[model samples]
Every structure is written in structure tokens, then in C-alpha cells.
Target: MAEAARGLGWHPFPGPAAVNSVRYQNRAACAYHGFCDRGGCHLDAKNSTAVSTIPRAQETGRLQVVTEAHVRRVEVDGEGRATGVSYLKGGEEYFQPADVVLLASYTYENVRLMLLSKSPAYPDGLSNNGGQVGRHYMTHATGAGVLALFPHRLNRWYGLPAQGVAIDDWAADNFDHSDLDFIGGGNLWVYSDRRPIAAARMPTFGRAPRWGSAWKAFVADNADRWTNCYIQKSTLPYEDNYLDLHPTVTDPLGDPVCRITADFKDNERRIATFVQDRMVEWFRAAGAVEIIRQGLGTMGPSTHAYGGTRMGDDPETNVVDRWGFSHEAPNLGILGASVMGTSGSHNPTLTAQALGWRTAAHLVENWSSIAG
Candidate 1:
């Protein structure tokens, strides 16, 4: 597949992954269990914070992990500065005070928490006096997909999602876009991720019935003969695509849930269409007998959600400053993709972690000024 991509003038290489390839830091290496895609790694080989950073922080005796706590709002003082947070635990409400507050509860929840924490000093919401808390929102354009069928088995029963070849030549301004209708591109990935249940549910390509002997026969023969390519395109935030409190729906706690008003614009659709064509060509070059292309669907909730508390230099257009601190509430910091202003073609995890470390370092270096 890498050779095929290189033949098309695209840069292809092994996709970067966070899973441990060998034993490190007393953690076991990847066992190739193949269930890492949807299930937890029993060997603790995946580099999740729960198994990595949290354990290290706990050893310092300064970090506390409170399980089953539902944070409701951020408490503020008369001067519109964050004081702490109020949460519900064991059917009792409690307030935890702090000198500095950091909100890192993912994108949607971060926006929702800020919106729900309205105070007398800031009547709209926390850090929302300028109404920019949820202005710019985006999710990766990841719906467009291409499935290919090969004549022989791929033997892909044992591998992880990251064990694949990726072509980034079409990703995010890497190639010429002067004559193109869109500004961003997509990253094409073909990985070894096959589960028995999911493989049995493969599309028959109009070769068999929906269910019965013919379908069972088709599944038995073609379950290991097909594969899909993942195409993640760059998405942009727009004025109309924002998040807000749902007027009608509420959670079990009676608090309003987040309401998303978003959709893929023309630029995203154009990129998906263009990239899928390239993907089909690549699959054909790799000896695919039949290929199925999916359409550019409407944008929905995504794991790669970004930008509800956008970071920027201007307070009027952004919620946080360049350092990820709130422009209105100086001591309040955000530590997730919610502060990201743009969604690139790649996953936001590494960038988010890097930004988080940067924020933490800045806070430690300027603790006196920020915590005050």
C-alpha cells in the first residue's frame, strides 16, 4: 500500500501510535490482542493518562482522584474570578476551593460547564461575557470511507488500529490547493483492524442475500478478504456551527444538555469527495477487485470534537488567551481540544497533550501571578 501511494506522488509511511512497542516504565508491551481498538488493553500497553500520568502524579501525594463526582459548576467570586467547583457525590453536594482552576473536561462538557456556571458578575456564563464561549466549533470530517474487496484473505485478525500505512501528501495544505475548491485535505489510512463480529457483518456487494445460507456462505468466504480505508479530513469552524444549552432536553440531573448546531460546509464536502477518489485509485492499484464508496454525510457528534472555548488573542472572538487561560477570568485555564481554533487532518490528542503541558509549565513558572 505504501508503494502504491508512493507511485501516486504521495508520502506514505507507518502511522504513528502511542501504544508501547516494547516493555517500558514497568508497563507490559503490546500483546497484539487485536481488541485494543474498542476495548481496553489488559497489558496496559496503551499510553492512557489513567495508566501513565495519573499513577506518577499520585506518587507525589499531592494529587487526588475522586471517582463518581459530577461537577455542576465553577464557583466564582464577586470579581468574576473562579474560586473553585461545586460537584455532586454520594447524593451530597460539595464545593472544592482552589487558588487556580483548570477546566479539562473534553470539548462538549467544557463548553457546557462554562455555560452552566453563570454568576452575578458574569450574567451570561463563566468567561462568556463576550459571548464567545461556544462560537467556533468543529469536528474532523471523518465520515467519508472506502471499502475494498480482495480476491484472497488478508489475514488481518491480529493487529491494532495504529499498525497501518498512512499517506499524508493529501493532508492539510501539504499539496497544491491553488486550483482546488477547498483549503484543507485528508489523511488516508489503511490499518489492520478486524474483529470476528465486525468482519461477519461485511457488506456483500450485491453478491448475496441479506440473511440465510447464501449470506452465511458469503461471510465465511469474504470476511477475511475485505478492508476499509480511514480518511480524516481537515475541518474548519464557522459562525453558524456553534454549541449552546439545549432549550428543551435535560439530563437526569435536570440540567440542560449541550445542543450542537453544526454541519459540514462545501469545503469539507469537496475535500471528502476528492480524497475518496484518490483512495479508490489507491485501492485499485493494490489489487482490489470491488470497491465501495461512502457519501459525505452530515456532521454529527465525534470523538475528535474541537473548539468551543476557542483560544485566540482577541477577547471578543475567543474565550481563552494564547496561554489557554480565560481572557475574562484570568486565573481560569482550559486544558483540552476545546481551546483549539482549528481541526487539522490528524488526531488532536498529541497536540492537546502538548498544549496541556505548555499550560501546566506556564502555570508553574508564573504561579504567584496566575494563582492570585
Candidate 2:
């Protein structure tokens, strides 16, 4: 695994191949935290796999991609060797043969696929010998700190949310932990830009009625004046929380959808309250006359899902080795956020991409050792 490089690190000089311009435009004002509000990144400004390696993979004729194909099971040979995968495509089933099958599906889907592909020799399920298929899940703890009612117009509605600023003074090991109740920290974010559709649903702060003339008047007066403070806090995995095949629900093709069962721990609760209070203080410092701080409530589905088949050296603890290779299935490899052992104070997309590249390179360089 590569050491996580931070934005705080030294500036990266533009290489000869770098395109020094904003490539995409996303004007959608309503995202996870109001970032990328421009409908979507129209210019493909964001560097996701959709713009990167997937294209390169396609260029290599050795690789075949079945876009709409939903893999139902991993077909194994007589001696416990992975041979191929059975999948559904347009109301029909098909099998694609491959010497080694790599499960690159997203976190939950990766685990579900393994459990779904049960065999006689691996009756308990491939790699489920110890029953550690879906465990140790982590989702970021999130809540908003809002401040409304100002004496003047702040001109709060424009610009990308994260494009404004992020103060990581409290994030990770950046601060001292002498008297803190929790070990982790948060990033303080403040930005303005809310579309009418989003502004209409702003938290009322217990002042205006849900409907009527008063609501209209309230919107008229404060639509462009409110400031939202976001605190992206850390979340740690607990023993009781995990993902598993749902007992009762299945998808359109008769496969189980992943079910999440998690409860935030006391450490997270402490972090949320502490961070909210800090955010409120920052809003006050920024000239907020009235601030409303909301604490972390019950956990919900997260965009940043991590940890299922975590990577580590010990098979007792993790499903994948440090190189993202499965310990049980020598030829199988795993990718995406599910293999992350720890969730840092950063987004996982770039990190996951880097890890995927590292894993693929390893397989290329040491193919004989891995495939033997």
C-alpha cells in the first residue's frame, strides 16, 4: 500500500502531460455537502476511473468489459481454482471463462458476490472458511452546522463548496490530543451556493411554518443569505456493525442486496459533539448572528463506504494480503474501498485508484508467483 500523500504536501509541479485547465463543469448545487452543484462535472474535470484506467483497460484487447453484465457467481474448478464467472445480461445468463477471476466490484457488492457463489468443496462459501466475509465496515459520520439571519446580504450563493476553503486544523494528527475525549478530528468547511430547489428545503430553524405566506416571505428574505458549515468527522468500526446478505430482500435478478447493520460508538458521538461545537465557534467568528448546530444522529448510507475484505498480512484478520491478493485464492485479486484497512481523513476515490494501480502492477511484475 502507498503512503497516503496529503494536499498539505509540497505542491506538485505540472508535468509535461498535464492539462493545466478546468476540464469539466458541474453546476449541480446539491451534492453530499453542496459540492459539485453544477448538475455534474460536464467537462470531466473529476479524475475518476470513468476517465482514466477503464479506457486504458479497454485499449488492451486482452481485457473484455461487459458493462451491463451483473455477475451472479464465481465458477470454480475441481481443485479449488477459479475458472470464470456466471452473469446475467438482458434477461439471459452467460458465463465468461478466465484463468483467474478478480472481483473489482464496489465494497458491498464484492462481499455479496462471494457469498452468492457457493460450491460443494467450499460449501460455507469461497473465502468464508472462518466466516469473516462481511465485517468491519466504516462510514463517515456527518452533520451540518447552519447559521441564518444576518443583518446584511452575504452574497452566499456562488462558487463550488470545497473550492472555497477547508480548515483541517482539527483533522487527524494535526492537533494535540491531551484533553480530547476522542482520538480523531474533523475538517471545517464553509461555502455558499444553493439552488432554489435546494434552498426551499433548508432547515426552518423552528421559526417559519412549513407552508403559507410566511414561508414565502422567509424564502424571499433569507434564501441567499444563509451559510452552511460542514464538519466531516471520522468514524471507527465497531464489533457489532457489518454488512451481510439481506435475509428477505433480493434484487431484480433474484440476488440478495447487501444489508448494513451498524450503530455509532461513543467515540464517534463524542467527536461529533466536539466538532459541531468547534464549527459553531467558527461560524460565530465569521459573523454569524444566529447559529444552529446539528449533531451526528443515527448513521445512514454513506458515499464513502469502506472496509469489508480488508487487506492485511494475517488471514485471521483480513481477507486480502497487503498486495490486494486473496490469501485463500492465489489467483484472485480484489479492488476498491473494501480492501482499505483504515479510513483516513481523506476521500477514498483517489487513494483507491492508486492502490488499484499498485495492485495491477504487482500482478504484472510477479505474474508467475501469483498465478502459479
Candidate 3:
């Protein structure tokens, strides 16, 4: 891994051998079974929030977590200030009041809650006077390059998703794209995974059949020969790509479900093409016996969703101010990717956490003024 990082100029952005979360932390370390991507960790080796942060907070005794609380909306006063939140717990509705309110839900959930919490001061929703609560939504575009099949055994049967190499030479504005049709680029991810399911699903190359006895035999013989090059492209928010409550779709509580009305533009498609072309070149140079070309598909909801309640200095164009506090509702603080102005070609988890901590700190430092 170090050799690959040095060779490809990839700055070793190494973390815990396991995926950073409370989900995979059982048995001391990650088992490297590739199930990290599909399901919750059964071995308790995962570091998901369930095992780490929540327990630590409970230990403090000052924090009382109301489990299974499905928040419906943030309660607002007549003057548009957030008073607290109303949630459903065990089939009963309850209002939890606070001196101040910090909304740290998912991007869609944050937008949905604000839009639902309407009042005279914020008929469109709480802190939505700027009409920016559900606007500027963005997500990264993902596309896979051709399946590269090698003749030798890769011996890559076990590894976490983070255990891989990344080439950022083409991502962001690292390279000059003044002459290209696209405005952004994608990170080329080269990872090793030999899960049986992944091998069986590898795209057939050349004239190889997709099904039948021949296909089964082919998979068995070359299961270890195939690998994929992934692209996490930089996708920007546009006027039309946004989120709203679905008119017809409602949750069990009759609240409107989050309706994602988003799609990738030509810029993303062009970036996929440009990035995949380079991926093909790299694979060919690495002596791939066959390369099965794949197209960049349409974009959709992902874990990396961002920018529904964006932050900026201007109240007209943003929902929150520079400190993650709402411009309309002074006491409301928003955390997570909802306030992110831009989407880079990477995961927003760490960035979101950092912003959440910053917002909390800011609120703590100026609690008296903000709460008033």
C-alpha cells in the first residue's frame, strides 16, 4: 500500500484499518470480510456511532438520549425563533424544548423538517425567509471504469473500502481543464476486492457470454482476474437540482417524504468520460488482458448529499450565516453537509463532523447572545 501510494503520488490518507465509525468495531479490529459495504457489522468490530459516541454521552449523565425519537419538525415561536422540536416516540407525540435548537439531521431531513415547521413568521418554513431551505442540493456523481481482467492472481480477497489507492491528479482543479467541456473532474479510485459476489458480477469482456454454463465456468476461472476503477466526480449544485417534500409520498406519520429532484449535468458526464479514458489508459499500461467499458449512469441519492440549507454571508442566497446559524431564526444552528456550499470529489463525513463541532463550539461561545 505504501509502495502504491509512493508510486502513484497518492498522499497516504490512511486512517484506522477499519472504516471510521462505530459500526465495525467488534473483535478489536475490522475483519476485512467486505461486508462493511453491505450490512451492519455483526462482530462489533465496527466503530459506528452506536458503539462509540452515544455510549460516551450516556456516561456523562448530563446527556439524556431519547432513543427511537422520530423528529417531525423544529418548533418555532411566533417571531420565527426555534423553541425546540416535536418528535414521535413510541406512537406518542412529544415536544422537547430547549434554550436553543441545533439541527444536525441528514441534509434531506433537515430541509424537510424546516419546510414542515411553518408559521406566520416563516410560512415557507423555519428560517426559510430567503427561500433557500431546500435549494442548492448537490451530490457526487459516481461511475465505474471498465473491468480490468489480469492473467495472474491478485490475492485480494479481503480488505475494507478505505484500503485502496486514490489518484487525485484529475480530481477537483488539480489539472488544467480550460479547454475541456467539463468544469470539474473526478478522483480515480483503484481498490482491490475479491468478494465472491463481486467477482460473479464482474462484466464480461469481449465476446464472453453473460449467462449459461459457459458464463459460470468463465466466472470460476477468472474470478480473481477482475477489478474495477471507480470515479467519484465533482458535481455542482444548479438551480433545477433541488429537494422538496414529495406531494404524493408520505411517511407512516403522514409527513411528506423527502423528494429528491436531482440529476447530473453535462459537466458531470463529460468528467466521467475524461476520467474513464484515463482509467482505461492506466489499466492498459498495467497489462490488463481485457477491459469491459461501462458508462456513467444517472445520479441519485447518496451518503454524500450536500447543500440544502446552504451557508453564506448573504441572507438572500443562503439559509444560514457564516457560523451555521440561520439568518432568519437566530437561535437555530444547522450542522452537517446541508450548509456546505460546494461538493468536492470525496466523502463529506469528516468535513460534516468538523463543521458540526465548529458550529457547536460557536454556539457555546456565544450562547447568551444567540439564545436570546
Q: For residues 121-152, write the lDDT of model 2, one tens digit per residue.
A: 46766676657778888877656455555546
- How do the residues 1-372 of candidate 1 rate in per-residue lDDT, one tens digit apiece? 888888877788999989999999989999887767878889999988999999999999999988899999999999998999999999999999989999999999999999999999789889999999888899886578999999999899987877789988889999899889998999999987688888888999778898999999999999999999889898889999999999999999999999998988999999999989989999998889999998776676767999999999988999999999999998999999999999989999999999999999999999999999
The true-versus-predicted C-alpha distance at residue 115 of model 1, in Å, is: 0.5
lDDT of 3 by residue, 265-320 (tens): 88888888888887776676667888877867677666689999999999999999
Give every collision pair in model 1. Answer: none
The local lDDT score (0 to 100) that residue 346 gets in candidate 3 is 78
How many clashing pairs in candidate 3? 17
TM-score of 3: 0.92
> Which 10-residue window of candidate 2 scores lowest in summed lDDT?
11-20
Whole-model lDDT for model 1 versus the true structure?
0.91
Q: Which candidate leads in lDDT?
A: 1
Which structure is stronger by lDDT: 1 or 2?
Answer: 1
Off by over 4 Å in 2: 1-21, 24-40, 60-62, 204-210
Q: Model 3, residue 254: what's the lDDT? A: 88
TM-scores of the candidates in the order shown: 0.97, 0.85, 0.92
Give the candidate order by descending lDDT: 1, 3, 2
Total clashing pairs for each candidate:
0, 12, 17
